[model samples]
Target: MMGGELKRMDLTMCTTTHDPAPLSVEECERARLARDPAYDGRFFTCVQTTGIYCRPICPARPPKPENVTYCTTAAAAELSGYRPCLRCRPETAPFSPAWNGSQTTVARALRLIEDGALDGPGASVDGLADRLGVGARQLSRLFRKHAGATPLQVARTVRVQRAKRLLDDTDLSMTEIADQAGFGSLRRFNTVFAEVYHRPPSDYRNRKRKGRGSPTGHRALNPEPLRV
Candidate 1:
């Protein structure tokens, strides 16, 4: 768990409607190398060599600092074309509630997105914005500025990351996994999984099973809110 003081600081940083005082590249690099838990959800380390992004607390050997870039959010890293690191699954990292500053509409929108509000049938950006009392265009701009991805992009990443966890931890069939992950069809699920992970779902599952002796522990896609 993060200390209350750091959580408060993160909230302050994220609440500003404009750009906040983001961690410097040098500071991020130091945190990544140090595996600092305090910085875990503050920024993600994307390795240029592997094209993978990981939580700062990732247990895999740290890559060379020169090959690393940092993103303010996992969504930002994914938008930059980096895949989540399998070893230190970014999906399992604690969600920073600070990202939802009380003043920003984007913060409320993000909470809805994380709760599968966008995964249901007939959900659309326009509808989501209407629910939040904003126009779709304004919502899109807010997402681009704060999350570094479109609403649809963030939703898709959330689904895919959830599916990845299911593949790793559950014995469910592919169809069931797809359904549970909120992918409307197995074809869509397969396409997105391959696009992000560079392999078919079954191949990833088989490889993971062979590598590990037991199922990896399951962590909910959304962690408990930051202790304020």
Candidate 2:
């Protein structure tokens, strides 16, 4: 676990940003053993033996010191193939403000992806990377490090989440919802929705009209970046 070393990227608009170094192993270990709520989201404990990651305040029995590694963010731990602890619910842990070099780049890329940069025909990660002034491979590494998921995964989650919101809040037809959510076609929308939520998109359509009409513009998209 190379904790906070960020390689330089070709992003010109933003100069190098320094993030605080991650908590030391000894500090994290002490916090975990004490189960200190004050230290909750500052760092996550990765137990190699169980392949699980937990908040410092996890009530579960601690793993041996040799088996544990510390990650600054849930994304980092998840990127390293550790699953979040059910007891600690690390996903719900308060976010840390610190971000290493490529993390800012990932954030920009995420916004672009969310705004349909990769939604339409001819859009690709290479194109998106070019917009961010980085290479496709480098962007992917940054995405994995900062988001714990691929860019496409993030886009797909955004689309699905937006589709769900459209389903619940609007009276849009399935086809319209599919298009608005960036799905190329209704069939494709149904397939992915079913795979993610284990239910078809139609099943989630809002039934109650209540004298409300669909908004002329699309609703705000705020998808929680899921680990797809």
Candidate 3:
């Protein structure tokens, strides 16, 4: 998935400063139109019309050039008010090579977040920053500069995406899905899922099942399962 190739490129090539540089509109457009694998994860294309972001290699029909905008990172796209594309599933896209090199602190923080550092007991911004040997304020600033989202927002996205995967790929109940996906409580899970996807988690799961065959060979449960 070009993840390996991205790692091999010089990290310095990804950004010249602490903040990532914006992708060239012309080049990003070409890559989006071509569905170029080389450019996948290098930048995300946010469709203004749909309010969804996708990887360059997404198989969905490309939006008109005027309706497309590019973000240096998926986090940036999400922060810019775009949801991950249902067709392309931006979460499954390869990690941006730049993430590996340009900013090590942000990268390390992201790895920890993905591992659920922020999901349970003792998971505070101050705690995470201390683990990384930096102050909370500095860590927050760095996250905003590099990832385009606060550490909490990034962590929430990770949790929400995990919950989505479980919903799509398994018959897990909402409570089970919430726990397995690192949401401490169903109430919090439902709130965050609604904020991100503009629907209840159960609604999303039902819609996905109707559009694509159930992955686990069983009918999806009703939205009633989501009630606390």
Candidate 4:
């Protein structure tokens, strides 16, 4: 009886290990090199030269194999000290399956976040839960488990992207941009943008132009806040 129990346990462990989730580092590199959109949400790739990481389908030229490192999540990469890519906008990329792999509630929460639900004035977990037909506590649990970011962190990231887009694309005043980008104030917007992107909005815009006049005398697209 003891022997049979031990065999069953070993078999169960083997099955569990063999049936593990689909996460591929080599596959991620192949997808990055191929610029395959199918794997965009599945993995992130970091370029050693730039210190910035991007989704697999980014339009920028592919880095050499020796120059790339695969990252499982944007947060993981950020935690490892990589900055988000200006070209790919990892924040705006589709939510990872890991975020929704276990719970429908967390998945929906992420979708809502992408839609700018939590960005504007007075957005709250209670209101977010009411819309999702779930409780605040449950929503928090999902964010903690999958996103590696609190609900507020997710929302704030989205807002920063919005601000960055405005800063780079339009000559909007900081105050106007802040309001349109869903920030409570220009100070907050500037602070957050500087923190995440490592440059003030003005500095980012200048660097993007590099003192060259715009081709059409109009601002260039940031390409970072791609919504489509």
Question: What is the C-alpha lDDT profile of model 3 across 69-167, one tens digit per residue?
Answer: 676677777877788988777766555543344378888999999999898876788999999998899999899889999999888889988998999
What would the per-residue lDDT of candidate 2 be over residues 121-199, giving only the tens digit for each residue? 8889999999999999999999998899999999999999999889877878999999999999999899999899766
127, model 3: CA deviation in Å?
A: 0.8
- What is the TM-score of each predicted model, taking all chains together? 0.49, 0.48, 0.49, 0.47
Candidate 1, residues 1-228, lDDT tens digits: the string is 111112212433432223355665667677888899988777777788888889999999999876776666777677778889998888566544433432368878888887876876888889999999988998898888887889999889889889989998899999999988988899999999898888789988876665544456554354433221
lDDT of 2 at 89: 83
User: Which residue window of length 10 is worst by lDDT in model 4?
Assistant: 1-10
1 against 4, candidate with superior lDDT: 1
Query: Quick one: best lDDT, which candidate?
Result: 3
lDDT ranking, best first: 3, 2, 1, 4
In candidate 4, which residue pairs get closer than 3 Å at backbone N, Cα or C atoms, i.e. clash? none
Give per-residue CA lDDT, model 4, range 5-116, as digits (tens). 1111122222222224455555556777788887765666767777787888899888877666665567766776678888878866656553344477777788888787
In model 4, what lDDT does residue 7 have? 18
- The clash numbers for all candidates, in the given order, read 0, 0, 0, 0
Clash pairs (backbone) in predicted model 3: none
Those runs of model 3 whose alpha carbons end farther than 4 Å from true positions after fitting are: 1-102, 213-228
The count of residue-pair clashes in candidate 1 stands at 0
lDDT against the true structure, per candidate, is: 0.75, 0.76, 0.77, 0.71
Q: Residue 100 lDDT in model 2?
A: 43
